[model samples]
Target: MFDVPLMKKNGSLFAGIALLLGAFAGNARAEEMSLQQAVEIALQNNAELQAFRDEKGLREAGRIRAGLLPNPSLEVSLESGALTGNSGENAFSVGVSQEFLLAGKREKRVALAQKELEVYRWQLTDRERLLRLDAKSRFYQVLLAVRKLKLTEGAIELNRHLYQVAKERLAAGDIPELELNLVQVELARSEGARSAALEGLLASRAELSLLLGGKEVEPALPTGSLEAGGAVKQAQAELLRLAQERRPDLMALRAEAEKGSAELSLAKAEGIPNLTAGLGLKRDTTAVEVAGLEGKDTSYTVGLTLSMPIPLFDKNQPGLRESSARRDSAGNRLAAAASRVEREVAAAYASLSNAEQVLSLYFRNIMPQMEENLKLTREAYQLGEVPVLTVFEEQKKYLEVNQGYLDALYQRQLALFKLEAAAAVELTGGVQ
Candidate 1:
């Protein structure tokens, strides 16, 4: 897959303004779109994928041209005068000649061209697949930014309410001025966080817009569940195997090397001789006058001429050397591609494993514990057995856990994307 580098934070802010335009319109217009439909639109319209499709057409054209034989040439010669018994006479003769290729050059070229076309076809397919996955990844990032915005917004509102309560308590001499200041500080922090999240959401939407190759994408997120299809452990081996079979970039490199090999062979074969043979009918005024020779009665001449290029100064020596070097270079690139793919797949699996474990922990232990602790602390504070400060601390911890849960969920989904990219296969059946 082609690399989509991470956006620099400060630089991203300016770039993302266009991303928030739709959201602004949505706020003003109350219209938004679902994520799945957005992904479908992106896949259908992404400019990069469309460009690759154009490239595929060129490769196919090359294949068609390669299958054709060399065109024959017509030759003409004229003698101004032919002396017969001191009589001035002139005759012109015309013939056609064609050179047959030696050492199966045409077939080899067609084979190489066919391979090139196949290589391009796979590259196009791979790009389409990556574009779809990229759109989804960007979608999740936008959602995460929105989700974080909501959390911060909630936190700010709660802190503002608590600050008012503390103000009342201080007025009644129930709490110190320092406690009210602390609540005000918390409220300020929450508001700052909300602004930061809003900025991130804007930037994320812009990045997503670039991926979609358009400005029509919106920030309203879909809330449906992502079904994790197969067990993570089972999918690991499956991904590795599929990558070996289906990694198109690697296959393209191999095809390129094979094409170079064929070029080298063609260069070596260039020194070989080819048969230039032709058949022709000839008619002259003298022949017509002497023997009543007409078009059909003209005598036929058939012969073969052997032609070859000498190994003097330039006997395809440079071409062979260049082709051989390129073939070797392509072979090295293929080797590197295989190594990189292996590492990429392994790293993706490791990340998937760790992310799954993290999500499981958040789901089975941390969130439940945080929720239970918050419930008990709320009860205690209501009974006046514990101070409201303890209940507030639990409340903060519960919110943090909720944020962590969202982080785990998005991280796992991103890991799944990476794994499929490395493997170059739909190991999860289809992306959600």
Candidate 2:
């Protein structure tokens, strides 16, 4: 005889253990983070961004070096006439000299360095702007993957329920064994799809984690919808104007042009040779023989000297030409960057407009019809009013349509990211 109470007790104990394990697993899962938080983390900890930021320190050091004055030179000398048999005839001298910069060379150097630093700052800002776009793009990719996984899971559940119903109909002699086999095959397909979707989700999460500077083992769950938040209301003209005014890369190019001009001026100033001024004190001693005694006479003297190069051969001709060419190049580059920005903004704007239209169509027309058809087909299959193949076709169609909508949503988000990057302005207010 079986011990009924003992078996019931054992079953309850096993269920309690399973529930506890589930709770522990849920607790161990990483917390969900918002898009803004994700962006902030990336900005703070991303390795590439941090390395770019380190370059600012180098520019700052250059500025420091440019403002500093040259050190003064010191000269000391001793002259002894002992070798020439004049032991008391000796001279000692000390002098200090400074090279004074002419044509405002030091000031011009400082100006050029300051302008270069400004260019670097603008370049760093441009890098940060691109990083924000990248983070947002990756965040949306993870969101799309999550939705795909969920869709696959739902498909698996639906197929499993249909398979169970088909088995019952086969036993009741209302459906053939072939129908049950078909449902079984569809369920297996759904399972395979779910496995692929899970793999995709994991890959997307890993990519997101790397972007956010998080360890690969600690990927945070993204908490947001894939729905298009709002339509881009800005006109192309307005976006172009914004890009011209606010784009950091354009600003950097303009700064570079100014820096080149400063450099040319510095080179011109450098062609003027600096004047070196020296001040010195000297002492001289002499031996005098009078009667039978030797006496020493000493004299002290002060002198000043000034010297400068004639600049006959090297007048920094090469430097001047190089700076001039660089200035012209910078100007041309700025113009080209502006043109590229215009094209990018136009292209992104058109893409976003098209994506919005497609997403709207799916939302208003296609998806509702797809859901209704899937529901009706499922009901008809359960009632034996439709063949198994009809239900399978409808389910597959529903899954395909939903996946297409998800893709549309993902594409629209990508278009928004590109537009924001091109225009160098925030269209949607989030972590920007």
Top lDDT prediction, candidate number: 2
Model 1 reaches what TM-score against the true structure?
0.76
RMSD of each: 8.2, 7.6
Top-TM-score candidate index: 2
- How do the residues 194-217 of candidate 1 rate in per-residue lDDT, one tens digit apiece? 889888877887787777766554
Taken over the whole model, the C-alpha lDDT of each candidate is 0.69, 0.83
Q: How many backbone clashes does candidate 1 have?
A: 0
Report the Cα lDDT for candidate 2: 0.83
Instruction: Give per-residue lDDT, candidate 2, residue 246.
Output: 89
Clashing pairs in 1: none
